[model samples]
Target chain A: MTRPALAQLVAVLVRPAAARELSLADWDLLVRVARVASLEGRLQATIEDAGMLPDVPPAPRRHLHAARVLADRQHAMVRWEVARIHEALAPEAIPVMLLKGAAYVMAGLPSAPGRQFSDVDILVPQARIQEAEQHLFVQGWVCEGYDAYDQRYYRQWMHELPPLTHMRRKSVLDVHHTILPPTARLHPDPALLWKAAVPLDGFPGMYVPGPADMVLHSATHLFHDGELENGLRDLADLDALLRHFAADDPHFWEHLTARSFEMDLARPLYYALRYGNELLQIPVPDSAFRALAVARPASPLRGLMDGLFRRGLKPHHWSCDGRLSGAARWLLYVRSHYLRMPLHLLAPHLMRKAIKDHRKAKREKSEP
Target chain B: MIAHEDLKARLRDAGLAIQVGPFVVRLRSQLDRIERSVALFYDRQLLPVDGAPFADFHVTLARSSGLRTVWRPQARFFLDGRSPFRPLPLAHAYPLFEWGLNWCIAQHAHDYLMVHAAVLERDGRALVMPGEPGSGKSTLTAALALSGWRLLSDEFALLSLETGKLVALPRPVSLKNAAIDLIRERHPRAIIGPASHDTSKGTVAHLKPPDSSIDRMHQQAGPAWLVFPRFSAGGSDRLQPLDRAEALLKLVGSSFNYSVVGGAGFEAAANLIEQSECLTLEYADLDASLGLLNAVAGGPA
Candidate 1:
């Protein structure tokens, strides 16, 4: 509960200028924690924005500078990949809605800088999803080797198709027809997102979700998704998105709150705003919290959820971990699956994964 | 600097922090083989700090846990409590540590434009020899390091991005296969570590770099020559001029983080080639190659 290193890391991230006052030893721990949390690039970007690069000590500066370089290169690659995706899908007249990191970067959002992600996620109409996949295949994007069960699980129950990797470039692209899985407890209509999508300038047939949808989708991906390894990074993304969008529009919070209720995603929105304010101290209006009162969990459950998320969201590093950090992360992982699917389907899927992992470990141990 | 006895004691208990060029690596090992190897090769660079508060890398060479310990004991290389490589045989602990350190630098140290080359310096000018495996690059590096040129690195040529200078990361030169015996014979005083056969790189041994190279580890040298060496069985000892543009492309292709560093990487490589005499050296013999390199360094042939 009392992680001084995590506290210091958060302080530096929220206000990078404070890095000027940090001791050499703090920089050492900060670099390690930031690297583990995948926030090194974000830290570098913020520090540079504050013009604190020259003031930082040489040893730590090299790491930050290196991360910035990597982030820039990754951003450029994402831009190029988006262009290629547009090229492949444009021929079919299918609209390519850029999602998450790729969307942030192409749309020139403030959340884009220093952000690195592995896959390019795109959304198309559910009716034309197959048609879009055909075009992508012709353009050298083939589905990665997912097992029969996983392939079936994705096609039948999941929102997105199994990830397609470009054969030559080795870049992954996730094609989705909706935001959440069909079996998930909440289904924010993909139609609403597509309707509100804004076209990207200079890129034909490519669009990014509207500001409210961007924040909602990021919040959903972070709080609803099973893997929280990059939990803190995703939270940071949410923080940046909210700050940027709120400043750009006078009624941004109102639009976000209304959209969350309109599309069955108020819970994630509520949690996002709550954590953004709690963890990163991003300002949220009292009216907005009052508006999402229906989505808030009961007092006892809410307290437990907060404890789990608070521990789960920190960088999964030993330096940042509490006594129950591992347990909290594991419980949240199970909770995510519970939210995504019915118990019958979830039980079998998890059991299969556990068995397969055990066999894999056994096989490895038997190797000479 | 810490004493050898102190270093060994620390290696067995907490860890021994040693300065390797620009980075401080804290090494720990319970195995006697690793302890002996560290005492032999890294005796000069051991810091007096009892467990350095801030290390660029924290690496451990420890015996692999589980059943492998009883039948075929193996050693694993861990960086920050996670092993990036599979466990090698217990006898191969020293070589594993060396390879592991190279992996750590190549993977994380994006501050510099890292080239897959051996670099040496003389008269304040660096000679970077970029070559593919089995090109006799390490063998040539060993020859030059013994013949008075201060060894910068045998694996990576750390090119500083801010300043177009070669930062010295002088460590033990890794010699493989026949080059081990070759270097041992050529330089009788050279302290070569115990060779571990059947490695992925074949038989591998590390030659302890001379004291002068370690002493001037902080010294940065302007890149004066870029030589791409290709070893042939009976090829002519020729040092022919290579086009700068072609050399730039080759350097980019041979770099570890060229694409990661992006535009800055391209500019750095181009600037290095532009400032240096770019050449392709093809030689069959070590002595003849050394003669040609010395001539290029403007030393007495």
Candidate 2:
């Protein structure tokens, strides 16, 4: 099959030098796809890192530059907010482990530059989660107006509290006690993660997960995520993290595989490795795959999941989608909820969401 | 460049790629009002889609689909297949397109430090008038463009971050409410489009940019003066010098992406203020305002 524009974007991301050969028309499509996937900044960073920005056509170069400027500004704001968050919780002595994007940025990881973030995610010990919330409340971060039912859902079943918005700055913060919901099928013990967390430089109370745990957390977050609008961007993060970590440590993959099994996150790691290798062509050791064999789904289910994820992982743009792409995304959304909670709880939650969405569409359509 | 009929056909089918100063926009619409608006306001900017291999923004102004099409029909604006705004009444299609295009530029064009202002150039120096709504900035811009100055833009002042120069993006000069008849009466030769009533901005029309302005849209000018214009009914025309510090703050406040661009935005705004004469103009009469502005531009009063 001929590579679609999305495949070309993936190729350019994997090998930034490939961008030199793209036609103006190709850049047009690539820019649209990358923007929709939220990977434009990442693409810009990779190309700039490769020192091939001058090789890009002027028309497309402006877009890359614009995205970079926005990302750089956001990175600065995130640093400031993280510092404020550290200050808020320092008195309580809460172990604030920066998760995902904030972690990548604070720790100065390869994936840090050019990543866009909507909120900061931090993990704390489950016992002190309320103490962390109380401290944040004193610092002027209030939970947004979620209805009673929604609040109950988050506080009871979800891993993170309802997102808190800073009154003055309007920035969002998500404080999680664990990587996954307490009720999730895959329970990665928070204790192991906390033990392995490393303190960020110049930040006494703040920490970032170690290299193996970081990769596992990213993989778990992506595979278990319900929304796939940024699926490709999240996968690129996994690819970047794996590539950087594996290259930095010779025995990285071995340690990651062992840790995934220990944390009961072997399945997400398997999917992350498979998709990263297949989609972006990130090099993965064959032994890693063999080690994850016990965590793979049954043959038929594996085939089905492959079909869904293959369609779901591309940019969520019309040009990148096939006939069943919509269905694949919907099925994965259901699968994500199922992974997060048991069927009894999942059914009601999805039904409520569907009803609310239907009402919203109706209201919009009826408006003049 | 393509003929009018070809532009309409392409707009109804694929899209019509038009050069709008520093950006290429692909506009697709089936509405007759949109076609007429483009013909009237952007006659010189249309480029053949095949020749223009890329577009910075792809927008569509279409009549709302389904039951709304028959009852209280609405026109929706979509940029790259996603609507950034709720649909307006079908009669307001042209204004919707204009507003949507402005949003596209303000949201994405971070390469330039954009301010909510009208800009015109005279003798290689730009006059930047930053104004809030009901401040008569657009009316003043229409007057200036009609007089002789090259219109840079009627809505945005795109300050290039790289050169610290004002880039021209001269499109239609939108005249709201009473300003519509005021311009038509003052400048009889000005080509103004049919007015759309009951818009969110109340009774809006567009004045076609002069051929001279569109012809030299690529020209970039250095900042010469920053004027904050306010319209006061029956008030005498007055121009007062504004402190550079206050001018910088107001300019930053009027900017669309000043905070997003951060330090560079501050530097660019400061440099523009530092190099230009900053003033506040409050006037009632168009002719008086024009004369005062001309004097500020160092031209005939």
Candidate 3:
């Protein structure tokens, strides 16, 4: 590649915030780095056919080095946060399951730092959130102001707890609560989550989502929430699972299907796998997608119509509403209200919520 | 009514114990572990510049997740109920604590300003970066940290309105693909861990805070400079001063709870923005950024 071309390639790979261009040399370097084989020759093979990396030297050592740096940082954050959680929940002694990133770190992957974690996800018994909060308070964690109405709406009606803020550290923790908000229409209780949780190797009180459940949750989070952008990573997670866990257990697929059905996340799982296989070359069985109704809508025209509205249409009935035009906007507002409370109690709930919020806003304004 | 003894029994059932500075908090019958962390343990949540409580309030809380299910905020603790749904995973607890606390203050205190940014110091001056994810905030923070700046925290840089001291809680520096490699090559001895791929955010790697940074973890620094650093793959390093108002707006936007703290948080943010020289930095090369930072870090007060 020429200097300008290489620079452009560098720009694409590095994504530096300021400069929008890369030199030819930069592109050559990036191409070399992309071809490195730290992961069983995966990178080498992945980039082999791409013209960008043709005849390039082995990928740079910086890739592994970068992975190590991220791993360390993530580990520190996870460990410190875990310890802090331990400190916060000392009273209830309810065992906290180190979900997602925490589990990833505890299982050992220090080179995989900067895993783009938005929040530290964890699962505690529903009975223990308040107890959990009390423990955190003494440790310099504070709660952001929400009117009593909003608080009640969330506490009484929502799935997880409202987000929590650490007073001194200021790191945000989303003290969830139930994976699915209580108000969710989905069937089945969250208590089953504990049944599927397996303890971490050395951490006595902590656990991880079972292999099957982990895949299911990832799919649900990705598809249920319109996670189209991070599809690559989400699929990568499943691939990582196949590579890491499938070898140990032959019943993985059966368990995965059973759990997906039990949790009502089968469709999402099927699509994740199907797209993953198509996009990233994850080799999931065709039978899986065939078993589920993931045929991308029988009518292509109908599918397009459905896709337009279903994707960004109204946010409330996002699951069921197929038509694009009508009370969609109003439905979303209504949905937020319902999300804030059950339908029958919507009117009174809104009244109470409004009063509470007014008072909170007043108080905050008056005090500081 | 559930007596104090009953509450104690419920707490015992849950099995919780916590130590905050010099206090040992035991939650026997309480539903809120975090409330006690602030109220019962600390006479006041915010310490003034003189190290005294900022206000007459003991503590406050605000929650958004469990309203319909766990809204029973009685002093009477119920430890026997099983949630109908799976609780959030434990990995989320720390961020939850931070967010919950923000709600409490934003809804209740209305007396402070909160800015979303990370604060680090070297030679007594603090570098504040306020940006969203994918903005290269964490990447820049890690690069600067490995280059010899004291990392206050990659996630938060807490400024106690009362004490005028920036609280240092050195945590992990999250890095993405290329930045991860850059840091590793830059600091071969750095400690890193497995990268969790395909998260809602993206591929993420966490870098352990440098041991030296952690060693000076408790040492607080005053606000010095607030610079929002953006990494451009191969862009030249540039740093330009920003006005207090614009800088404050940028910093507040990065804050997890600026509106909640209301004036106090705003004042705190405003004070820092005014006291510091604010700048926006865009760099492609760590070396170039490091050179720029070294000059800035070493320059006269």
TM-score of each: 0.96, 0.98, 0.42
Candidate 3 CAPRI-style tier: incorrect
DockQ of every candidate structure: 0.61, 0.79, 0.02
Q: Evaluate candidate 3 by giving its C-alpha RMSD to the native, one decimal.
A: 24.6
Which pairs clash (backbone N, Cα, C closer than 3 Å) in model 2? none
lDDT of all the models against the reference? 0.88, 0.90, 0.54
Q: What is the interface RMSD of each candidate, in Å?
A: 1.5, 0.9, 23.6
Clash count (model 2, backbone only)? 0
Please tell me which predicted candidate would have the highest TM-score against the true structure.
Answer: 2
Model 3: how far residue A260 lies from native, Å: 0.7
lDDT of 2 at A126: 87
Residues A7-120, candidate 1, lDDT per residue (tens digit)?
777888788878878877777677878888889889888888888889888878888877877888889999889888888888789988999999989888888788867789
Residues B1-301, model 2: lDDT tens digits:
5577887899988798888999999999999999988887787888856778888998999888887479788899998888988888999999998889899998889989999999999999999999999999999999899989999999899999989999999889999999999999988999999999999889999999899999999989999999999989989999999988999999999999998898889889999999999999997988898899998777898
Every model: Cα RMSD to truth = 2.0, 1.5, 24.6
The model with the greater DockQ, 1 or 3, is: 1
> Best candidate, DockQ-wise?
2
Lowest summed lDDT window (length 10), candidate 3 chain B: B74-83
Off by over 4 Å in 1: A358-368, B12-14, B50-53
> Which tens-of-lDDT digit does each residue in A1-368 have in candidate 3?
22232223223322323122333334333433222211212222223323333333222222322233333444566677777876667446677776665766666532133343435777788788788777777787666877576687678876666777777767767766666666544443567778888887755677777777777777666555343333334555566665556676876776777778787677667756755564445666555655665434466743553444333322121122245534443443454455434567778877876787798789964652
Question: Candidate 2, residues A123-158: lDDT per residue as tens digits?
Answer: 989899999999999999999879898899999999
Off by over 4 Å in 3: A1-71, A109-114, A226-231, A294-368, B1-301
